[model samples]
Target: MSLGGKISKDSALEPRIAAIDLFCGVGGLTRGLERAGIDVKLGVDIDSACEYPYLANNDAAFLLKSVADLEVVDLTSKLSGAEYTLLAGCAPCQPFSTYQQKSGPTDERWHLLGHFERLAGELNPDFITMENVPNLARQSVFTKFVTELEALNFHVTYGVVNCAEFGVPQQRQRLVLLASKLGPIALLRTKTKRKTVRQAIGGLPPIEAGEAYDSDPLHQASELSNLNKRRIRASVPGGTWRDWNQELVAECHKRETGKTYPGVYGRMEWDQPAPTMTTQYFGFGNGRFGHPEQDRAISLREGAILQSFPKSYKFVRKGDPIYCKTIGRLIGNAVPVKLAEAIGKSIVAHVASHSGPRKRQLNDWHD
Candidate 1:
């Protein structure tokens, strides 16, 4: 029943788990699950933008289709003979994001989770996992989702997990939920200390404005407009708009109303974890995105690395113009790979405790 292949007797505690990553942007979840010893059979996403990276980086087959149009049968087809099936999905959370809190349910992408619920009911995989912005846990639809899983007699564990505590370098917090039909379920243990920005990005080679680093695809920076280039020059590390000169300030910033909220137009401090990464992380005007010392925004590769993807994580082809809109959506929309790995490890521990042991040593299963 082992996935990929049978586990050796010494590593017998390993479970033969097969997983499907829904809304699998660039296979972050799939990569993490694989790292935690789960076999990722396929990844499903509506955005063809995810197809290249998803396929190039992992063994999972990438299905470029909207979750709304997916059927339980289609998903099952990918795991026809596998045992211990696990269905994992992280619906697009922009609608539930803090930035969109004022927009309410008016955001159209909010309904994508319903598709996950529907497929879960039909396929009835042994385990289910989902991750989203913490704000989602407070929504009525999220409440209903929990209630439905409870009614199905599944043992469910849901909570907001700080990504930094799980070794992700950024201070991103996500609501992670796990439900299992087999006995009880829970999350993995958090690392005792959180990781910081310097510890994570300190080792990468430095790059100049509007440039990419050698030997790293994820370290490329965004193109700067003439006006933004000038604005960024005035921004200081961990400091906000107050650092800008009056003439260079935007009209919006000049208004007394803009004086009240000052988290924008700031630079990240090297000693602390970086501000929560947003879609515009490559744009200096967005959040505390300026390099700690350099007068430029964090590069695309740095943002991706902070999100816990490998240095080689492919976003666009090597020669492409690095479409900001496309890469931003991919980065901002991803479930940080480190967080996903933690969730996967938790599930593996849960299944191992309930399912039994093998012939090989437990540590051997780590690979």
Candidate 2:
């Protein structure tokens, strides 16, 4: 399947693969799956904020409900007319992420995966898939989820996949899982080139620090502090804080522990994929978010594009103020749209070849 262009439709004779995107933050996965010709019936997420973007860019219903509260009937009702069902999601991955290891299963959100597993068991969809931080593979809940799918006789394949290899312009690593009762399913790689930061955002018009482009508010970059401006000036593409003049470095960097942290206040390289986009990507001190040649950090629009969202993708109404925290979290936590599209295409191919009487039996769960 192709990336970064118009949505492509599969032949009409294929079994119609309809889906429900649980934890569909900002609709990244939904948009990608739609591009690969999946009929996403509705997206279920607890964030009321996700509603606008989820409904805006994708032709699907947005249900503002926790996955824990989503009864099987809710998804079945939405997917009733579907010929084949695909239950797809990425439960919020904080508890399992390396960056936030202190948050364990005691964190209420950790059980969201368990809820997903429960729903998967009850729904028995023809296919199931999830995207999450790669660290999730080490957790017991993941083990249980996989074992249960195997118990259901679903063929499952999962592993850590580099986002750049799948056309996302960021070097984000995610654990992707695919389960199908149709046959031995796998996440075959796309026939595409590794994407780079330059390919993703090189076409955008330039803007100064704190300047919102005249016509595009999402293109606005955060204003840098006077000190940060000087620091960025001293930085080179893909270089670390060590490149800055000694006086330009922060006292924190002088600390023994901070000496090991080279990614902070760094610049992204134009020829390579960018460091993973974080919630603070708009701030110059937050990781290597600096625009490769530009003096400012990447704009919100640029970050979204790196996540493989089309430049025209809408996050809010035209007059709305772009709240960085909310939108950043939405983009940072999203399953890269390009990766989702690749997975969707793989699923479509597997179904086209492997679908048989077993697919009909699994669809019986919807009745």
Candidate 3:
């Protein structure tokens, strides 16, 4: 057999599995599934920002289209001939995110999940999964979502999981729901000790203010405003506005309302897990965005690491636009690859136990 033919034949008998990543921003979830032995066949997203990272890092095709415009038949064409189809996605959660709360059915973003439900109804995939901000569980939309899955006769498990517990190295909590027509499904094994920031980023090459890493573009920091640079100098690691000298503080920060939100403009402590990374993580005034000990803000790469992407995972193509906003959106929007990988492994384990023992080894397949 030709080399290509041999591999293709080998793959078919090797417990072949395939997944479609919906809202596959930068393919973080897909990256995790690939780590857990599932082939990511394709990805779909509304933003062009996701195309390069999703396609370049994972060997998958990217469809730059909104889920709202598409339907189950569209997915059928994409899958074409795959044996096992896993419908997986995370609806954009900004409308329901704790960071920005604007609820009710009138919120247009809530309808996207309904679109996801529409696919589940028509495709009836063997497996389905989704992740979102933890508060989603409390919303009526979430209740409706659960109702739809159960009505379709799929066994479902949903919970709020701390991503840090799964070695994400960031203080982020998300709602994860896994549903299966096969049988009962659960999340990846619960995490034990949480991984810390030092464990995740301490070993990276150190960079000074306004400098990028020689080896990694993501590790470079944006140039600081001269006044902000001085303010940062007075800031202590793990300290908030209380650490700033009176003269160094921003006038807006001196206001009464600003005093209540001290976590903003604070530096991370080297030994702790980082606070949740936001879309504005590249900006100094957003959240506890300062680097743990570095005088400058955290680099795009640092944000990626906090989101649990592997160091080798490439976000931008060789000649693609390198705007910070684009990079930030990709990193901020990803479901941490580590968390996704864990979930994938858990799903596989559940599948394995229910099904008869296979002839081929599964761990090697995953590895």
Candidate 4:
């Protein structure tokens, strides 16, 4: 059965357009799209850990299935009655991430994009979007995916977008693709003012490492080893382990290769956007996650805020012990919500322009 079909005119007259988010980790993209007036009907992810946050934050159903195992029929069934459908599949990006050891084509995750391409071809949704590490733009997989979308008669546009340019308080660059059968579409222009680390999370009540804030559980930082604590005490904001006294240096940093990773064990500058948060961002030793003046690594909430999640975004239920690793992975892996909002707005504008007065008439009828 074809994926595209109309819901009742009464439903179409509503203000929001509709989308389904594939590989929708914790519903970051879905949340942003909803904020920009798109109804994200469903989110699919392989990790069950995503279910809580995904459902808690967005008005959507969560499917705990790998994209490779997902049937177009299943997706079509869920999305069968939407007036305009957007299929967004931002497959696992670890294979293309610069921080990862280059696994090349051998990585199984590399093939997940092919699955996304296949589903897009089968569903032939009105619009398509994908986001990944900017390095993916240089890979053959990205080229093949774009070519396949074009072959399906999609007008595709893609570029590397800097999240800091779009109000995310982190220096993350991502490859964003927007394809539509309706007509040409592109990302909205960058915002004039960039958000800084101070602007994003500077107001949070302070908590020591290993301690959860009394009111906010996610604002807890991971505890440091005594040695690591000493190292952080000496580390300057934006300065690496090189600034440490010889006694405080990790033995690894004395090696040639380790010296090159100068961003590690570094403090964030209060006035600047934070460095890209990796899966291990809860640890002080990972990347530049240290707080500018707090003498502790950034808390889980801080990382989530940097990812542009609302300060109140819930990742875990009350009374549950917040595991740093689990929460860190969720926060670090999320698409910056602001970036997704920009994408959502662009899609909405494209549809509004293409649909023209018919959509306006529908709105008038509803009014």
Which prediction has the highest TM-score against the true structure? Answer: 2
Worst 10 residues of 4 by lDDT: 1-10
Between candidates 3 and 4, the one scoring higher on TM-score is: 4
**Model 4: residues >4 Å from true position, as ranges?**
1-16, 357-367
Q: Write candidate 3's Cα lDDT for 1-367 as tens digits.
A: 2311111222322255667888888888987887777767779999987887777677678888898887665666555455455789999988888767656568788889998988788776768999999888998888998999999888999998889888899999889999986788888667468878888888888897678776677677778888888877777778887787888777787999778888877788888889998888887778788887878888888888889887766777654546888788779989998899888887777777676533323222222
Q: Each prediction's TM-score against the native?
A: 0.89, 0.95, 0.89, 0.92
Highest lDDT: give the candidate number: 2
How far does residue 128 in candidate 1 sit from its true spot (Å)?
Answer: 0.9
TM-score of 1: 0.89
Q: Which of the two candidates, 2 or 4, achieves a greater lDDT against the reference?
A: 2
Please write out the lDDT profile of model 4 over residues 1-367, one tens digit for every residue: 1111111223232435667899999888987787677778889999999998888777788999999999877676666445677898688989988767767788889899999998887777778999999889988999999999999899999999889988889999899999998889999895458889999999999888888888888999988899988989999988888888999877888888678888888899999999998889989988899999987999999999999988888898778778888889888898888899899888888888775432222232112
lDDT of 1 by residue, 187-290 (tens): 87754577777887877787877787767656777777888878777777777777778787788878888787577777788777777888888887777788
User: Listing every candidate in turn, what is its Cα RMSD in Å to the true structure after a full C-alpha superposition?
Assistant: 5.9, 2.4, 5.7, 6.2
Candidate 3, number of clashes: 1
Write one digit per residue (lDDT tens) for candidate 2, span 175-244. 9999997788888775668788898899899999999997878898999999999999999998999987
Instruction: Quantify all predictions' global Cα lDDT against the true fold.
Output: 0.79, 0.87, 0.79, 0.84
